[model samples]
Target: MALTPDEIDGLRELILAVYGPVTEELLRDLCRCITAAGQISSGDEYKLLLAKSLAGADDVIADTLRRQTDLTDDAVEQLMRWAAEKTAPLEENESLRNIAEAYVKVTRKEVANVLGQLAAADVDGRVYPIKDVYRRTMDYVFREVSSGTKTPEEAVRRATLRLWQRGIRTVDRSDGRTFSVEFMAQRAIMAKMGEMTTAINEKHHDDGGCDGWEISAHSASAPDHEPYQGRQYSDKEYKRLNSRLQRRIGTLSCKHIAWPIKLGVDSPQWTNEQLAEMARENAKGVTYEGRHYTQYEATQQQKALENSIRQCKDRIAAAQEEGKLGSGELRSSRILLRQLNAEYKRFSAAAGLRTAPERLRAAGLGRALRPDGTLEMPRPAGTLTGSGGKLDVEEARKSYSAYLDTLTDAPEKNMVWLRYFTEKNPTEYMEDGTLDAPFAYDPVEDRILYNPRHPQFSTTDFEMANTHELAHRTDVLNAQGYKNKAFVDAISDASKAVLDNAEGFQRVAQAVRSDLMKDILSALSSGRLDTGFGHKAEYWAKNSEAVPLEIFAELFTMETRNDSDLFFVKKLFPGLWKEYQKLF
Candidate 1:
């Protein structure tokens, strides 16, 4: 089994607990030393005072190293139990249990030895002995205070920030590489789990005399491994393939697993076309703040943001503990934390990714505070309001929120208000009766007017209408209104693609089909062409210029809901689908 977010968080917390507190205390002591050494005339005099202040610092460092080793051993024990539970049935066998235990024992020692090193570097690329890092930090603090460049409190806060940002680095001098203690621990744990699982699976395959295996499939798989997933391969063929791949299956950080299968009995789990579509969807990732990010890239961004938030919280706590609650550092850090939290929500909503609360937590940190001293919490992405209607207002809001959750690229928060009306119409009908449509987008007022009393107000119908109207609002905000040249060109290309595959279009479910010809004919005969049609294109020929806008909205709804019409669009109108994806 893969490591869950909770499990990862727990491991990180344990690793940080081992070193984080020790580093914090060290900084605190150094700050105290700097504060006590007031107005030293020369560097030598300041060094003497600092050395006296941190008299037993060496002993403290030694004690911390010992504690870290002990904690690492304990963490490894927990990790082993987790791994054993994941490979359950196999653990019942004594031989396998013994094998796993022996491997864990050896890995545990290596992890402990590596973590015992206290070599770390600061933000300015200054490397220092873990024991001597505090001295250098205090020296910098003293210089700033004595030179009148910063107050004693400000210098202390800066030192705290630097320590939290870098954490305690475990350096590998051989390759000149450094890793935070938490990162190193995570890597060791994942590697151990992967190796154990692979060993157990191989033993099973051997005992069963299996000649073939199937690899598991997951979203956002690495491109090199995408083709091999959800497919059955003979043992020999798989071996040959694995040898040539850059990242082989069952490797560290590779989530794929090879399960034993009978050569002629088991079939592939997914069809080639489905796999191809999955790849296409992964490639066409969501857009946030004008930057495109694949699913994997988005998750990575979330991790970075989560780390920064934790650092901010830590800085605030350290400042408060030092009785510098009103310090500029504390105030700025609080403001930045709030901004990070809000940005996290907006980015997650836009990318259609769920936020992991566990990842945002840090030990000994309370809720962030606002300028008024009240606790601050993140707000929802948008709001829904209903007026003058028998509509289940709460239900409507819930339904709208649910649709937003399903969107890969959601509209900007509060970009358009949602107003529902059940007993009355908000806008007069157009000459061709398009304005009286069930859902209408009012660009001037920046709201979507929904008439739930319309005949097509079933659950599914409501969802479709919601999506269709939201698409129009999104288009207007993003594409400079629906009649822009770029949108019109895209619609023209998609229309051509649809025209080329008229037979396929006819096969689409009637409810989902956009019958442009019927609308064009009605507009020609109705004599309503003189007066321009409103928001929607009920009569295409009447407002020929709006054909692209109407088609774009319909296609957007289909794509968002994954309606069957979209399958036909992708199959028969590849050009159209490709163009449609770019508009978002």
Candidate 2:
């Protein structure tokens, strides 16, 4: 087979263009996978094995993973043991890498969040969680394919052509009593023994392992082994082709702290006080209304309002100051103060008071204090207001199950079990999306916010909205105890250090951005195209290698198409690539 180095570069560069630069570890892992493209047991080869192994029994995969990824030889042996037990996770990240494990956690959270959000996003609306099977299979393929052969286009052509050209066939070496190739190709490179063994589903008569599976050496093929497809894969041909492509996509996605967090300044020449004073000075030029307030009337109105409020408070004080005033006088002063307080409160809250009576009396009095500089104003408190009731378990389950029917291979998926595992999680706050996470926010409220809103292509809001929350979950709130402290601050500090170095540009967030974009692109490509995807495809391509990866976050962000889309499982991430645009 023929392939080229430039194609590998193009594919890698294109991956960056579409997905973004992968993380250091993932990049390293991909490098290892790609470099070992022609070599046996490369990344992609393992992935195929793992995929085939996991396609049937998930428990086996889980058990193997549980024993592996422990950073010890014993763990490796245990993993080997379990794989032999149920066939096994054949990929590097599958129960093999800690980051991969972490990734599963993050993605699982996304799945769970979609379910939770879907249940809560709508009250009386029909929703469908969109899914695409071909895209998923493509993901598995691309993730393990190696581009290190330096002949990607050629290799792709050859691999695609091989299926039709000479075709594949299996034979028996009656002497060795093993399954061998009936015909040999000009350059049939042997990549692995088991890859051929597994690919052909060749059961070794002498092989020993759990059930009817083969584990050890590929000594011979079983006599009862049936023919594969129209023919059998030559051990040499099978390994060569499988390993070639396997290594091609055996790319490991590395994750790192976002560039903004990494690029954080530790010791600037200007101190915090200096920064604050500068902010105050900057604030001086603008009036409260967010416009200019240089001349008389504008400033005068503010002054008058202050004076009026102060005068009201003074009246209240006076009633107490002089004992000559009756209870009626005190009542009148309190009412006057309240009216001034009401005016201020009205300005603060566009909505009328929803405050409890006890809070009203105290907060109302505090508002009166804002008039006089001497009187202390109470600090405004933020509330996590949300509207939703307990989920009708039956309805939610029915909707989710119905949505599952849209998928191609539902029975093989164990994710439904997870649905039974997690009931709906309550959303106590909205601030989590905007203010709660670390790094700079892209909110319209802040002038320094990186990007303004990019409208989604779909008329609905649920898909992206669902994905957006899940991204937040993965990015910031994945682990426990993050809510308890300023963890983002410390992480930001460290990430800032990483970003200061040139290597920081190749952080994990960048890779995730790339991975997601590629997945989205693949999802949109083979499956039904949404037709209305704007320049989002270009946006992802541009940010594929963006430095300071925080700038590329838009690549993975999603929003709901509508309230129903929020709660619907079918639409969770369903082929919505347009929403990723503008992060570049």
Candidate 3:
């Protein structure tokens, strides 16, 4: 289990507290010395005073580091216990408990060694001795105050804010990257816990003599892991699967858990249908602020907001301790904190996600909220104009007739079919008066019906719809029925090509203006094209038999719209578009 937000906030507060009072006092004393001396100097008296001000900072930092290490150990132990209990049913002996104790012992030693080396924190990847940080901070404050760049109070406030914002950098990587002490600690603890849990589960499987393990499933699983979720695999198969993945199962940051199970004896946790439904639900994510966000994306957004709010609180606390409560920086930070909190709540509610208030908690700070003490609920995005409005049957007929009149240059055979169908089937309202099934063609009755008030019609112009229907009519007439082998083969070939060259197809999808095209392309890019086609393809392609026909009609409409769209269709499916061109 990941450390809850409250735990993380606690660690953050510890790190901030390390520098808050000490840094502020150092700045104040340095400014006073500079004021008396009229300028900062390297003389022995100045050096002596500076050394005296920073004398106990190292002890304070070391003590805080020890406390942070202890807290981290506690959090890791708790997480281990949680994992052990979760897998307790499968445990045959005290081995899991032994594993937990050993892991915690080893982890505590390792973390302590790492934190011990950090006698001074690094800022922006630059390690500084405690004396150097004080010297640099003092120099900066002196320069700003003496140069008229800032008043003494402003300079001290800025310096203190910077130190608090940077936090204590405890981990430096070979890649020349550095992370705050708490961040690295949390990451290491969680990673070790994951590894320990994986080892324990493997031991259980070995002890139970299970043939394989079943990977757990969850909504919005990482893209690469989604395919393997809820499925059981033999030992060899599981190893081979991991060999192909950049991120193996049960690795750090992966929430999936595996348990031992006899292949034939233990029932699968999820059926195929259930897994498929989970994938579909994940694909159909909620829209917030006019942009679609998958469940994973939504959670990430929430985390980001939480981080921002925490930072704001830390800054505000630092300012208050510095006695700059009325400073502009503090005022802006408080205002931003409120906005961030409101947004976090609204976004979670809109996305149908639960808000983790513990994650929003900031150590040593009260709740930050608007004056009304209530967060505003999010409203649904505005509805499209004319959506589900009344349909003027005669006007729709006239519109289609006028559209057909412009296609006189079309092939005689196609024209005859279109004109005949237009006369035989006058446009009429759907029985429900809404376009629940807008712009449909019934080949059995040789009928064409439309719902002009459909929301989709708000963006899709009439010419595109008419051309699409005409294309469908021509396909039926030429093939003598909807079961056209050549048509299906062409669409199948194009679809395969699209899948094979998904990146290129996405580029083409980007160039197209049609929302339908964008949706189809997005699905293709995400390996969900078939899923999209089955569920919410085009309005015309609702069933298996109709997919190819609807795709062809869609491409036909795209080609007829403008030269740009025609080029896109050609780029998307060169062979299919070429073959379709002969129809014109």
Best by lDDT: 1
Task: List lDDT for all candidates, in order.
Answer: 0.56, 0.26, 0.55
Best by TM-score: 1
lDDT per residue for candidate 3 within 438-498, as digits (tens), equals 5666666555556545565544545445566777766765643236556556667867777
TM-score quality measure for candidate 1: 0.54
Q: Write the per-residue lDDT of candidate 2 for residues 1-584, one digit (tens) a residue.
A: 11122221222221111111111111122222222222323566656744543342234223322322222233223322322222223352233333223333443332222222110001111111111121232233334344344333332222222111211112222332211111111001111111221322222212322122111111011111111111223334444543554231112110000000011322223344654453344334334445554222233344355345544433333233222322344457566656765555543342221222112223222221211111221111110111232223333232232222222122222223212322243222222223222123322232111111122111222222223333333333332212323332333343343335424323322332222333332222321223232234444345432111221222323121121112211233322222222111
How do the residues 324-416 of candidate 1 rate in per-residue lDDT, one tens digit apiece? 422566567666876887898888788766565333232111122211111222111111223433344544543344233223232333223
Q: Which parts of model 2 have CA positions greater than 4 angstroms off?
A: 1-486, 507-584
Worst 10-residue lDDT window, candidate 3: 374-383
The C-alpha stretches of model 1 lying farther than 4 A from their native spots are 1-45, 52-55, 65-68, 147-161, 244-246, 317-326, 357-584
Candidate 1 — worst ten consecutive residues by lDDT sum?
363-372
Per-residue error for 245 in candidate 3, Å, reads 2.9
Q: Of the pair 2 and 3, which is ahead by lDDT? A: 3
What lDDT is reached at residue 550 by model 2? 25
